[model samples]
Target: MLPPPIPSQPNVAIPTSWPPSAYTYPPLLGNIQTPSVHPSGSAGTSFGYSQAHQQYAVQRQFWATKAYQSSVADTITLCFKILREVPGKPKGILVRNLTEGEPNVLASITPPGLRQLGIQRMETKLTAALRGLRVDWTRIPLREIVIWVDLAHQPPDIAYFHARCMTGKEPQPAPSFKKQTKAFELAFVIDSEYWEEIEQQLADDEVRSCSFSKISNRSSNGRRSSQHTLDGSTVDLESHARRPSPDQEDDFELDRASFNRNEDHSPVCAFSADLTRALKVSVTAPRTPPPSKRRIIYQSPNQDHLRDALLEGGSSYSQLWGQGPNSTSEQIQFFAINDCSLNDLLADRRFQGFVCDPANACMGSLVIEAGNYLGIGTFKTAEMGYLTLLHLTAGHLGPRANEPVAVKRMYKRRKTPTDANPGKWVLNRLTSADEHSKILMEANVLFWATSIMNFTYSFIYHFIQSSSERPPFEISEIRFVRAGVAIVHNQSTGPTTLKCSISRTYLIEERINEAKDGFYKFINNGSAVPLTMTRKDASELSEFLAFTQHVQFYKTKGAVYLSDLQGSMQLLTDPQIMTSPLIGEGAEIFGDGNVPSAFNSFPEQHCCKHICRWFELPELAASTDSDTRSVISNS
Candidate 1:
């Protein structure tokens, strides 16, 4: 008899201020309007500008020498100290050079417009300026350039900036700021490896600058009195500082007319086109999906009668069609009964004792000794959406005797009230029998899928370990549970009466879903699809599991692949085996969860990351729009 369900823990009301002060940041400052200053060209203004510029130069000099102190040997750190703050304007943005003697001033921009120009634009400008200082990026790899923006606010508004790699053909979008404090301090960390390309872009921009100047001078009647703002905003001296002459005014009108006529042919538009073309030609195509659609073809003769007979009150269901020996050889014979190509793969010596081999198939029968249940007739029940798990002890079973084990059964849904016996409930016999068969079928396919996964993982692990180069992270182990269907006898009813067809008990630790779909969905790159977990969030173990799946899909020639991965860090359970429908017609080949849509979506969904690339797994060609149409039509 099954034990009563364990009582659930009582819900406790959480206090609004339950989180202590240590977890929270100080109150944020309110937004303030940025003032626009029209420079009067007074001695005071000139002196203030010169003083701010000098301070910036000194700050740059300090960082030039001290930059090596904070970073590793291969990287360079540039510190940008905010000398002056003007709300909504760029001023006093400075960084030091690596060269000795005098510190080269980088930029003098105010704080207001820095956020608008964004971190990526600032990094690009810094990179161009740094290149002008003749710093060898290759020697000290500038894959990521960190910019520290120290705004001289009352509470110290500080920020760090970096850009994402411009690897794609399209223009990379500007990075958003992540607020670190109550103050408007932000952190924008991005990365890019194309240094040479950026240098060329700077050269193009320089040419555009010259062209812009020539046109501006022609418009202003060759007066050439203009001040270029540090934040890329232009300030006209004739308009702001002094009244314009009639000839200058006429020239300005003419220049405006000319600029309006050639708006589409502007230098910015031309530069954008050139940049897009260069990026498109230089960048490699994104990763393709997994190859292979071959699924496991289960040719094992139907054993539905074994489950039916048990459901009809038989003592046991044996693979050998009779009373089997109480020994390990009996279990090995049970696995041999499957008679499929997957069984052949499992029989290999590499997977010996792990899942199956000639000697052992990680399967055995345990006799439930008298009054030996661990909780003494009591078991804890954990109910999930489709199955109910009972936590109990098998008792006096072998090496694992008295250890906690979990027994799983499908939730019975067809209970009817008995009129003859008032208040008594009875399950529909036919539905109960069908559910029993399903439980056994699911267990059988699960075992087969786990064996294949284990085999593939073993191959990939050994391959990586034996290679000349090592991966960045250590390859962690991932072992799925070895389970099988078993028949429980109801001794209380009478010695030979069948109890139920259920899964053999296996222990589990704290469980977590590493990846999942309808059963187990593989996470894609975060850019295209929104998922709870992506390639970035995957741990070393998850990556290895993903790689295993990749190899299995390809090695089996795309016949079958495992997904819906969930388990402890080392041990996993309840995986979904996705088989191509081309191999079999029915969904029940593996289980009800094995759908054709999931199988078809594999190429589009799976995001190949480091481990896949490390093994140099062959890329799966993406199906074109026409191919998809044909598949839909055929289906």
Candidate 2:
């Protein structure tokens, strides 16, 4: 489409009679008042003594022409072509001509991609949409676009800001052969077609002094974010005072002026990185300083004095860890709702586990706690949308040398409401929070499950050293639920669930000798198990009727088979043990008649597909099995 021509000098004399009238500038663009270029020596609203009204009328005639509005409108049409491919994300569409016209406009991009999109096609940076966080190397035709946006300033040079998308800085070294692939890569470069589109815009606007022809090599490359040296990297940092290796106090105080506070200067943040190991450890007050993360801080004598004064004024700091007889498990404190910063907690070594939320539906308050998973259950809110099913850490129950201290995960949601996009409404565009990021934490401690996976492993190992410590029962078999929820009410109650349905599939069906390892592999081999657990309705269990709010276990297991319900339970309806039957025969809770009222185990098969869905695996499709629910009393 041809661009419309808008005159630079509008307030000029002309014939009184012309069909042209006042320009109707787009209100959406706020009157297009671009630093006013009014005619010489006269106010924008003025005219001559004799030809005043006539001159003004003629200027309006020129301003009201169809040519003026087309310039801005055409740029949008071209940019729109590229933005339409993103599934549900907001991308940026910006257009800038070289020397002729520096009139660059940035708008949010659209979705459904190239062919699926409903716009014209362009092959360069002129039109592009940011796809997945990490890109596939061979899929796109172009792999490198020189970026020019400044990361430090806002209205982030949108052109340069996102012109390139990738994660992590490339480690400085020759980009040589055989280096293992990192998390992401920068792809897609600005294309020549983009410049052509701008040329088209200038052609439409007659008054455009800057023409696309004059503009060549309009953009160049620059670093995105100014990065600082990591913890051990000795750059721009002060050397340690040659103090007597004995006056170790010098090692504890980090110099704040050396780096950026939230970014480079975070003393606690640098140390908390999961991948980075600290060479040394030290503690200081929160005001101590920010530098290498390897340093930590405690309430120093001076800090203690400050805390005391603050506490005297009734400050609301909930210091959970105090000097007490049973401080090991409960010492981790909970920061008040008013305090959201992890700066202090991150500095403390006790900040082992963090609880991001209390699993109620949709009230988005994120809570992080520091402690063991003793009584804590695993559940976290990853990015501000749906809740994730977190498997807590062994650190909570008990941490081991290398058994990932904690692990957290979220159930991936199949669909979400449009209203769920908070970033869009706030920033006036869609973002990652919109399409939704599918990842439960890779390894984070949120609930008791945290302890089960890590701590159980630790405890079991601890048991290995001294055979006397293993918790009594043989624990013949144990399964880590992919999406099972253990709902614990107040410390007084447990599993008081009434009605709920969770489907399952027999992922692995064959029974193996105790000698085999990796049942997941065995299951994938297509062998089948003949296990049977009865599915009962809500009313079948009598304990649920008597209890108020106990913890309910909604588990989604990888394998669905019949196994011995080894543990004996005191039943809700009778004194019989629940795994099997009479004195000799065991009666399980969900077993024949001994099943507790408050307890109902609706079993289901955990196929790869279902497991993928529960965890919201990005590569797999949603599981499709309806009417196949494993209820609590189905004999």
Candidate 3:
């Protein structure tokens, strides 16, 4: 005999005075089957056993009463089932290990419960409760059923049911990257006439189950040949829906002959009453293309080539990316991709190329990962570790797009307070505002250098603070421009310094008429000199004057060579020239390109050397020995 029912607990009352059609929970009752009792136990049970049976019978009777039906007992039972089965919580499958004091459904809902059931948050609690009764979906509306199944962690079939109910339309399945990808190998497999027969059988029979038999292909000679069994039933070869022969329909043939209906050359007007049904069937059997085929293309970086391509001067790009002398910890922080498994995604070439194109040119999704730092001048040395324009577009590295971009990772260096060496470098984290300030400061410096000082280089695209905790990266949009050489033939200024103090605008004004006249003279008689402002000419001149002024100011302020501007200038000079190539004029190396004597009298190298000189201003050294050593080494 089965164990007797448990005793009834005090029930929570549910409201029920709403409209008749209002959503209501179906009444839950204990199984109504007649209880079986063991004959031997009934004849020889002890007093305690007898009392237990009486109590059990009373409890079962109590549940059967109207009072039990009026309470939240059924909802509570459903809630218990969901709490037991759902995943990813203390009570769910994902987190099997629960805290010592976590409450179960029964404990949570009881009056003496440690935690309240949280009825005020009805959506979460009530939705979960309804979803717990998954097998009994008929109690809920179609829409509610869909949402409940989704939230309950039910299988995808629930979604399919909702889709079918909404519209007798099948949804196209998305392409899966996994191995088993085919949906159906054969198209139009089912015969429409056979399906109608099954429907008729279902409507007519009391059979608890129905199954397919076999479908045979019709041969060209109007005979059934290849046979396939579905269940045990044989599919008929001839369809009853087809038009009957004229011999079979004698009256129709007679009417056609009598009225000359057969050959009036008029079209027959036939109405299809089941057109909607046919359309529904056609729409419900949607065909989706098979999964995409992918070919793997691996790109392995050359460590030596990459390492050799580090940024110039004291700043090392590799340090930021753990490719240089400094370890990763020496830099700020890392920006990790959120939500998705970036490693797995990146490993798949198709996903990387199509989905995660850093340039975001593809039609698919795009994700940008950049580090963020908190302050201005984070990178005191030369910026490094940023992606190059070539690398970004080169199919061997990033996406195959013509878009050009240069990534620059900047950082600031500061001396630790407790360190003995006052000028020693140390890495530190900054606040978000500090990072914003740093970017703004760089923008300001570049703006002034570009607009007021007439400096020129690749322009910045935009600033992005990807992560506040990590050092930020910058992008430079590359625009190709042809460079012409301009010779500065001034004898008064040094190769790294400028002869003129005025800006490029005034220089242009002073030489404009002369340049026009010279050009006309040269074109006509091949006699005059050329006067043109090549790339970086203005920037070089400006930097030269700026550096000179900086040196003068710092020299008066008691700055020494080793510890001040002079030492800095030495490191920057080489890189600046390489980048700009206009700072130092070599008349013999680059032939004097017929520049006007008047304009050439005040030209700087028009290369990056002037920028280096500006960045690296020399201070007065302690003695001739130190100064001579520095000068000799720099030269």
Candidate 4:
């Protein structure tokens, strides 16, 4: 039998004044005696402060202080925190109020009453409510929501419902029922529209009495506008933005020295102290080394011998190159290939790489585990179009022993023997060794291109920090996994031939409690344009990424830029370098993914946003027009 629904609390009057001025709760140290600040800024002895209580107080204070901002991203973060920290009784009321109009539906779906509903049930009810309002729950801009329920105090059915949500392949099993509490976190990408709706509802209910006109006037005087002129003058909203003149640029550089000297002591708003500290840390962080200028020396068999050995399953690359003695152990040897010879700004050692060395060319080796390995003993497989990823721990007895590594092999289908062709290796529609090499080449190019992208991003980061108009902006540092190609011997089939694979170093880290998702594609390979403004893309991180691309295009003089920007908050992979065909003898530089048309269409497709205008990057349309005129005159 289901429990009766809890009675709804009477509607409390909303606070009239904005920001609430101050919180009355004890300073977050629960049950422990500590000195607390009084209303007059005097310290007083207080007791009963615990870690959880402190966290709750601080979070509530943070929400109260910033709630008036009405930012979609901020609201989602605040609401998620409230749901996680609030007690069951209050949480039930909050959830009920959030889904007010659909109480009957919520009750029908979750009969155990709102307070007793499991995390999964609660999520379902919230989702249904949002959907009823014509909102897409998937697009809610919430990357993750972690819930911990004291199962010792809750019903068994609630725990079972929560455990059932973990039905698919999970990194870990559901918490044991023997434990007092159970916890789980879900990661996903969400849209911004839902949050906007929630924000509007929140404003209408709680902040209806606040004077928005007065707040706007105060904000206008204190805050910097994205469309402000280089001279810090206000511009008309509808005006066509113009690039800063060379003289203005010179003036900016001239102010750099003074800006840096006074930066540490600059007056900051009281509410922005946390932001200032973060900015300081990021600005002062040690820079990564640039790409190596030294030439890459190949110490293995030539391309022909290596390809033949792989296809025919004959001699190993070590034997062909006479590098090591012949061994019976089925070992895979990976040689690093560094073919990046671009003499661009990235070649300079003075410039720092973002989060990794752009010239990370190294070798690695892995031994194929014996026994029931062919029967998928411990290897987990995830198949993509061109590559098949195998997740397994390294068995090689070395520093990397027992370390997790993802092995990537080109997806191939074996062909049956025919009179003319015989048995051959094929990928997609291509069956030749040359075609195989082309695919491998494309992979190598992508790996190198990631480094180039990181380097360009680093350059832009430094530029923003050192600029006179240093906007209070932050770009999340993006690092790609260090990867290299490995040639594995066919151990299961008696090891006469070698197979090619890419080995990526993998590491597990704690998930950050932030609004950003695990992975996002900011831009696509087909176009230079960025993704549409969702709450995630509207963040400062996404804006900076788009700005970096703009700066790269401008600095390179229309030679090259990067697109297909996909990855997590601080780590990225598989980037496409968009190069202009008009440059460097008119050839495709970074592989087939490097659509030259993307570069040509950039001017038309790109709509400059806040960061671009703040950095005073050259307008692509203007530059293209000037280039066209020059070409016509020359003709």
Candidate 5:
């Protein structure tokens, strides 16, 4: 039975010796009211404290660097290994953790000092270890490995070991005392035949050229003979059992679920009830929705499960973007929420001044302000969202100080909420997601499973519908997702994603300029659609081009280059541009030698039907000349 509540005591007057002084009323200004200022002369509410904001600024800088991220990825990848694949499950792999050091079976098998080696060197050793092992590569799926840290069971401290023994059953009392003593001595026994072979090899006159034999070999059958003693074989006794039959697999799944149901999850869960209570206690704290949808209630995942999921996903950063192998379903939703908050902040009127000071406009400030506006108190999830944004934004930037440059952040909704685009009450029309771009997938861009296929369809569709007198439609709007691109008569389409190798807007602008200077001048003045590119289009194009050039330069990949444009343009104006030193510089510096192959393949594709027909049009002399000129120049 629970104890009863205690009765309240009567109030009594206390002495005047208490530290807190009695409250006093402010001095009233009867007829002349004026604002009061502090003697220190510091102006209205200041958030300029450098030390408090330094961590966020530093984190942004660190994340911006490629070296830091690469190192972290390498370290995480090195922490685990694939044990084996479980049968009856296509995606399942039994993994063993190696981060906990030697007592972990995988750890004991690996050579010492591997961690001390550089990533490349370490990879070389790991590859050598697996070479010619005859293991089924398909069954052993390893994108990432979990690293468990358990302080209760410490790994062995010894540097070297000869053998390890493992069994499928738990230990019990020995049948006799003689059996116990016999087991101890047998465990330490060394095989004489294995040593003899090694000694003979060392004594050989042609040590470098001698053909080597296996230290030990097993027969085709699964069983071993008496001659094949413990020292004669490398048996992985600690390894998990092989794939189970279909019936066994079902039982295994049921066992796991029941075990979870019976388990006391509160203590093992990542966030306890106490934490949830504390989070709810803060009136101004941001509300973290449960790792589920259709409900406002909060729920925390078990700590062990969460850790295991992270390790399996390859990198924590990758997991935040929902790119990991084991990323949770709610991770994407959580990210979408943050993206909404970020979009709101960037689209806000106050962001203009903040972005101007790049030093103070790091993600931390974005998170802090976004949290305050959204009423989100969980900074950890906010931090993950910021990191995820930074990750996706790598090698990408905005044209202006503050803009939604990341393609993932650009989308349209109604200005005021109705049945359409529900939950998004307020919308910014000035953003990339204008009314026309809301249903991008339904537009001219026909998506396919592959980039080459999508481009082929787009090329043909444009070529067929395009007027011989007007400029050819520039291929725009490449989606990294389905690798789609739109081909239209005009440039009314919204921001093209960064996934495209070249800026379609820039190409369209260049084409328009070419049209104006050449015989296709009619398209400039009398055309139904405007030939010129708009400011918004130019800004988006510039950002895409900038990032593409950066990636191309760093990797020396001939995907796209700034020099390709100049070369193509100059060739039309001056045929000698092909022979000029500028052209030579383009070939050498920007790797233009690769461009011819790309151009050659475009005409051979089935998409060339309309363009081929357009080329045959001779009724309009100037139009034909311009089309031929553009084709020849591009080729």
Candidate 6:
């Protein structure tokens, strides 16, 4: 039988008011539905229950009354955001065990009757008396907004996380549940047109959701692909509206007519510390960020602007992302991608050969791993890990710092030692400075212009290794420029010291001229062992670590190019006249097909000591050359 209805006023007719269309609760308010009630024990009569009717007669009668409609319309609004936990907290999903006597997060705001029942809650609700107001979005202008939030505890380069050890991000293989505890806090309306911007975002979201379902239904495996596709599309759409890049529409077709190569959306994009630092720099020191949803900038020729340059130095580039002096405590800080993942940077073709001296060239191009947060595997020590070119970075691009970068793919992946460093090689033989020096001088002389330095190698390796001695493991980035530091690894847990000093910069023409001369000697003149590194390898490395801001690699006539945004992607050339270091008398190693006087005297050393220096360490150490016992033979 239908229950008796709640008592109503003498005039029980439904109300005609703005509350009906203004709020969502009580569903279709003021609808003229029959409100017959059956009397089981109420002061009013109730109708017998009809199974076919579905809804209760009493509920229908109660909602139909003008008094009931007024109550539901008083409901206020609230917002929420999904986020993940940072590192330095419990890792690998710590089981939740609520503490005893935990503070009552939600106060007792239920009705007088429900309050007596003593049911604790976590959400506080408030009632707002109604004031009839029209919400015509078209007529009303929108506003912009900037927001900031603070969470107590956090970790470096970790994302979607807060102080409570809760990571909103559900990485594959992690336990997930339907109901997630809310931990996000927000500060809104900081910018001028904040409201309008939010309204536009919401509108765009609605359109994308509607179209996403339609598009997915057409795919053969739409059901499984829906989630990623929708996410990728939503990000692209939002980026286009908010921060459009020049090459956002540039197409690079794969085998399929429309391949979903969403490389820009890697987990690295979600890194909080790195992004915050990038934004800080972008805004503080203004550099027009390359257009897109992708945050990385690759160095390319003036001909092709989308491509930014790669100046890498480190075998464990992945371990040191979004890092700074305070990176350890703050989970989400903005940072520069001076040492970006070569894999991510090189995903497109525009990445010309990672420029390094002929000496460190053996260290190879940037090693890239498109894994968690765009892992940049081991690179040569000759390359500097930190961004030497500070002016070019956009760390503080303000609120628009996270504008999705439009990365146009110009180059395909090429398999070479310079570019390939997967996640598995666990044993990296350490090379001594002397052996590396030999190679820098002999097989390659690029080392003279560029030198290598490792600050806290053991500190990093011990932290990242999964088990006993993985060749590539976690590395701790020491803030100071360490020189002649000693790393004594005793069971992977010990103190290490970094001894480094001030920094210095060199003229470009001088280095390149030496390179050209050495290049000719090694390739054209057919020297038994090429003059790679100069006498200043150590000093250059020390100075690079201690002082260089950023190493600018502007090719005189190189393979890559950069496109200008003002026009239709026109190629621009660097104005400087940088002669190859090998050509003129101004060159260090090779001047007019002549070896330096030191090489003339020290022929036995062959002026190629830098290359062999890196091999002295076990990871990069070489075995005895039984075939060529001459130590520097077989060239």
- TM for every model, in the order presented, reads 0.32, 0.17, 0.16, 0.36, 0.16, 0.18
- Model 3 Cα lDDT, one tens digit per residue, 111-161: 212112222222243334332211222221111111232222334223222
- Model 5, span 243-311: residue lDDT tens: 112121111101111221222211111112222233232222124534553356688989999998878
Model 6: how far residue 123 lies from native, Å: 16
Scored against the true structure, residue 413 in model 2 reaches a CA lDDT of: 31
After superposing candidate 3, which stretches have Cα over 4 Å from the reference?
1-379, 386-413, 417-423, 444-635
lDDT of each: 0.39, 0.24, 0.24, 0.41, 0.24, 0.23
Ranking by lDDT: 4, 1, 5, 3, 2, 6
For residue 594, model 4's alpha carbon misses the true position, in angstroms, by 1.7
Runs with alpha carbons beyond 4 Å of true place in candidate 6:
1-60, 63-448, 451-597, 600-635
lDDT of 1 at 339: 17
Backbone clashes in each candidate structure, one number apiece? 23, 69, 33, 15, 4, 152
Candidate no. 5 TM-score? 0.16
- Model 4: per-residue Cα lDDT at residue 466: 28
lDDT of 3: 0.24
| Model 4: lowest-lDDT 10 consecutive positions | 73-82
Q: Indicate the residue-level lDDT of 118 in model 1.
A: 36
Highest TM-score: give the candidate number: 4
Q: Over all chains combined, what TM-score does candidate 2 have?
A: 0.17
Candidates in order: C-alpha RMSD to true structure: 35.2, 33.8, 33.8, 28.3, 38.8, 29.2
For model 1, residues 306-360, the per-residue Cα lDDT tens digits are 6776675644544423323421211111122121234444346443222323353
Model 1, CA-based lDDT:
0.39
